[model samples]
Target: MAAPDRPAGGGRMLTGVTWAVLLLGLWLWGRDITDGSGGPAPTTGDVAAVGRPIGVRLPPAHAPLRAAVPERVEIPSVGISAPVVPRGLDRGGGIEPPSFDTPQTVGWYDGGTKPGAAGAALLVGHVDTETRPAVFYPLSAAHPGEQVRVVRSDGSVAEFTIDDVQVFTREHFDAQKAYGPRKDGRAELRLITCGGTYDRATREYTANVVVSAYLTGGSGAAA
Candidate 1:
């Protein structure tokens, strides 16, 4: 599910400035999510035509399950299988991402909703490093209707069905649209990574690739 070539840069994959901006958006998203008014409903035109899959029959959302800490996340269609590590906001007030040293790891925002719970669970990873393609390098190629499986610490698997994939440029980012739950009371998941072209002049990715999915089915942990 890899996108076209995205040559890498010499320094960190995602800069602090970018994360700060994203954190600002997420901060507002958190407030909206807690109020049971999930920002705004997503529109097909809200996503780029190329990323929006049309005419695919999506399943009804499964009822949200008990909270469970995610241990790993898998996107079989994109060949992504990575460990989930809990992360918190950094000194800069941005949600910390997995370190560059371990590009294959996915960072989960422990402060937010857990994978199988009643709100949006966030997972972030690097698209590529300076030397090689990272775990989420193929993320942009993932289409709607795909599946994302999260193995939880409670020994249950939470299955989600992809509904949207968007590439939000830094110039025009809507925090609520990118991070808020699409619908209140449903278990939602968001896989995020750097996207768009890498601008050597600015030393940053021009956009972020956000894949949105909702719980469709899952097995509960043994009682």
Candidate 2:
């Protein structure tokens, strides 16, 4: 018997693998990823060749690895209030827990590179907990132009205004579409967490909701 959905399943697997590979490549090329923040200075000729913005790459040793310490995150509609931490990648390639102890503050993936440079600056948090609630619990309900404030350690704050919220099936998550190219030379941010219906058998959510925004204004540091 021919199964109509067999092709769909295969396509989903391929999409998942491709997304995973793109993320891995970004992590491996952290220099190029964060080069947008004036790390490696690209020549005028180089920029002309690409016909797009190219981030300046800095020496690996001197690369700005320090995360932009967030003092607070305010989502008026969702009523979210918490601190942000620098998050790193896990051995399995997924985002590591934002914090080992609190698990309430959001974390930026350290391994992948910082946000606001060239590539996507990924911020992730728990939607909820078994015993108590956590940050990003109400993320799925956020609307466009909502404010997200991130205070850094250098006495500056990065304010982001939400542009859109998108929900993607776990089987069809696309990294390039989610974190790839941007026309403007401005920095971008992405907030991700599990959402959609819960699958008890798999013990996972059916989809992931991503909130993307651009850096509107800030003080202390660049990223």
lDDT against the true structure, each candidate: 0.77, 0.52
lDDT accuracy of residue 184 in candidate 2? 46
lDDT string, candidate 2, 32-69, tens digits: 45564300111232111111223432111112223454
How much is 130 displaced in model 1, in angstroms?
Answer: 1.3
In model 1, which runs have C-alpha deviations exceeding 4 angstroms? 1-11, 30-50
Tens digits of lDDT, candidate 1, 104-210: 99999887899879888999988766777788888877878999999999899999999988877666679878888889799999988766666656666666778
Model 1 Cα shift for residue 53 (angstroms): 2.8
Summing lDDT over every window of 10 consecutive residues in candidate 1, give the lowest-scoring window.
Answer: 38-47
Predicted structure 1: clash tally: 0
Cα-lDDT of candidate 2 = 0.52
